[model samples]
Target chain A: MSAAGGSNPEYVIARVRARRSALFGDEEYRKLVRMGPAEIARFMEESEYEAEINALGSRYSGVDLIEYGLNHNMAKQFNDILDWADGRLYDLIARYLRKFDAWNVKTIIRGIYSETPRDEIETDLIRAGEFDDRLISRLLDAAEIEEVVELLSGTIFADGLEAAYDDYEDVGVLVPLENAVDRAFYEQLLDGLVVGEETKQYREFLEAEIDFRNARNALRIARSGADLDPTDYFIEGGTLFRAAELAALATNPDELVSKIRDSRYGDRLSNALSDLEEADSLIGFERALDAALLEYADTLGYVFPLSVTPIISYILAKEREVDNIRAIARGREAGLPPEEIEEELVIQ
Target chain B: MIEAIEPLMTALQSEAASGPAISPSAAAALAVGLAAFGAGYAERGIGSAAMGAIAEDEDLFVNGLILTVLPETLVILALVVVFLV
Candidate 1:
C-alpha cells in the first residue's frame, strides 16, 4: 500500500490483540522451565506451537526439533503481521522487521565465512523480514562476502556494507561489516518519519531501544577495558549518549552507570542501576533493560490503543517468547538447573 | 423530490427576505442525512476492526456484528429528532 493512504490501525490492532492473547503467560513459562526437552516439546505441541511441531516432527527430534519449530513459528507469525499491515502501518512495522533482514544477512555471511553448509545456514534464518525467498536464496548461494555485498546492491544495506567492506578487507574482521548493517538499520528507522502525536511515542520507543543498546554496549566495553573506541559502537538518535560522550564514558564504569541513571530512563532503570552497582553483572542489568522496554511498550499501547504501539508491543512480546523458549530448550539440553535457566529469561 | 424543489426555487426567486434559507422539515431532513453519515463514518472503523477480529476467530462473529452496528443508535436518535420536529 502507498504511504498516501491512511493507516488501518483499528483493524491491525484488533488482529494483533487476538494474537497477543495467545502468547505464553508467566504460568506457562514456569511449567515449561520445569520440564525436560522432550516434555517441553510435547508441551509446545499442545499449545500455539502445535502446527510447527507436527510439521517438523517427521525430520527432526529433541531440542533441534523444538528450536527449528520455534524459529519457523516466529517467522510465520511476524510475516503474517507484515502481510496484514497496510500503508503507513506497514511502513512503521517493516522498519522494525528489517532487523530480521540484518540477521539473515549476517547469518549468511557468517555461514560463508565458516564454511558451513547452505542448509545449516538456512535453518538459522528467521525469514520474517522483507527479503523474498529468491533474494535470500541468491544470498545463500553467493560464495564470497564480496558477492553478498554486491548482491545487496540496491538495498538499504548496500551502501553501508560496501563502505564497511574496505575496513573488513583491511582488518580481516567481520565487526565492521556487522556494525554497518546495524547502523544502516537503526539510521533508517527514524529517518524521515512524519511524526503525529501517536507516532511521536513510537519514535520515542525506538529511541529508547537505541539508548538501551548503546548503554549495554558501553557497559560491555567498559567492563572489558577494551582498547577499541566506543564511538565505533555508538548508534545515532538516542537521547542518552552522544558518540563523543560515550567514548569518554566507556573508560569509567561508575561514571557510565551514573550517566545512564541520570538520563531520561533513570527512573525506570533505577533498580537496574543499583543492581549494576552492587553486583557488577551486566546480564541482570541487560534483562532489566529488556523488561523496562517491554513495560514501556505496554504503556504506549495503553496510551494509544489503536495506533502502531500495540502492534509493536505484540512484536516485542512474541520475540521475547521465542527467545525465552529457545533459552529453556537450550538450557535444558545443557543440563542447567531450572532456576538458573529461569534467571536468563526476560518475561514481563 | 420535484415538489420539495418547488418551494426552494420560489424562495431563490424572492431574494429580499433575509431569513432561514430552508424550511424546518428540510432542515430536519438534512439533520437526519448528516446523522446517518456520522453513523456510517463511526461504523466504518468499528466494522473493519470487527471483521479483523472475526477473521482471526470465527466465534467472535456474533460479538463483532453486535459492536459493528452499535453506532446505528446515532441514526435512531436522529430519527427521534425527525419526529419531534
Candidate 2:
C-alpha cells in the first residue's frame, strides 16, 4: 500500500470490478428484510460472507454474529484493495480510507471516556485504515484519553488533538476532542489533491460529500434550536456555503431549504428538500441524501473506467451494503415490520 | 563542421549511387521487429489485467490466458511483410 512506484490502476480496477458485481442488490435486501437475525446470518453464510461467518461463527451468534461478520468482511475487502493498489492509486485510496482511522480514534476515545472494556472497544474497530496493527494495539492499551492523544503524536491528528486537548481540560467535555478529530480528517481529505482531468469528477464528488455534510449539520443545529455557532461545525472545501453564510442560514430552516433548492445539487436533492419542508422528521431527508450520493458515485465510476472513482464507488456501495444488512438485522431483532425496515435502507 | 561534413556527404552520395544501404528484406525484418515491440507493449497492460481477473476467479484463467495473447496477432500479421519481401 506504500506509494513508491507507478500506479497500476488497470490491475486494481479489474479486480475491483469483479468484486463490485458480487455485491448484494435490492432483491437481497428485500428478502433479508423479512428474515430473522439468524436467518439473515445463515443467508450471509451462503454468499461472499461465507468465510467470515464460518471464522467468527463460534465467537458470536445471532445479530452479533452478523454485525461482526459484516465488519470483518468490510475490513478484509478494503484491505485487499489497499494491497492491490500501488503508487498514486495507493495514495489516493489510502487518503479516503483514513476516515476509518478517524473513526477508530473516536471510538477508542469514547470507549475510554465511558470506561468500556478493552475487548469490547477492540471488537468495534474496523481495521481498514493505513495505521498498522501495532499502532492500533498500542492505542487500545492506553489507559487515558491524554495517553491516546499523546500516542497519536506524529500523525495528521496530532496538531489538532494537541490544540483541542486544552479545551478538553477547560470544559471537561469530549466534544472538543471529537470535533478536532473530525475536522482534522475532513481538512486533510482535500488537502493537496492534484485535480487533473481524470480526478476532476472525483474532486467534485468529494465537494458534494462535504456540502451534504455541512447541510446536514446546519439542519441539525437549526432543528435543535441550540445556542451554538454553526461555524464550529463548518467544514472547508465545499462550494455550498461559506462559514459566515452557514452560520446565518443555520438560524432559518426555510431559507436554508430554499438555498439548497437553488444550488447545483438542487435538482438531485429536490425531493429530499421538499420532504424536509413538509415532514418534521430528518430521517427521510437523510436517507434521500445517502441514496443521491450513492447514485452519483455509481455514475462517476462509468464515466472514467480506469480512475480511482470506480474503486471508491465500490467502497461506498460495500459500506452501504454493510449498513443496510446491519439495519435489517437490528430492525428484525427489534421486532419492527418489514415495511419499516425497508424504509430504513438506502438502495439505489 | 561544414568542411568536415563535405567529405562524408560525398562518400554517402557515392554509396547511395551504387545501391541502397539496406536490402528490402532487411527493412521488412525491421518492420516486424517494431511490430513485435508494439504488440509486447500492448500486452503489458492486458496481461496484468488478465492476471488480476484470474486471481479473483479461477474459472477466468482460460479467458485471461486467451485475452492476454490476443495482441500476438499483431506480430503475426507483420510476418506477412517478410513473405512479401
For all candidates in order, the CA lDDT equals 0.90, 0.91
Candidate 1 TM-score restricted to chain A = 0.96
Instruction: Give the winner by lDDT.
Output: 2
Off by over 4 Å in 1: A1-7, B1-20
lDDT digits (tens) for residues A126-174 of candidate 1:
9999999999999999999999999999988999999999999999989
- Indicate the DockQ of the complex predicted as candidate 2: 0.67
Superposed Cα deviation of residue A43, candidate 1 (Å): 1.5
DockQ of each: 0.56, 0.67
TM-score, candidate number 2 = 0.95
Each candidate structure's TM-score, on Cα atoms with residue i matched to residue i, is: 0.93, 0.95
- Structure candidate 2, residue pairs in collision: none
Which number leads on TM-score? 2
> What does candidate 2 score in Cα RMSD to the true structure?
2.2
TM-score of chain A, cand. 2: 0.97
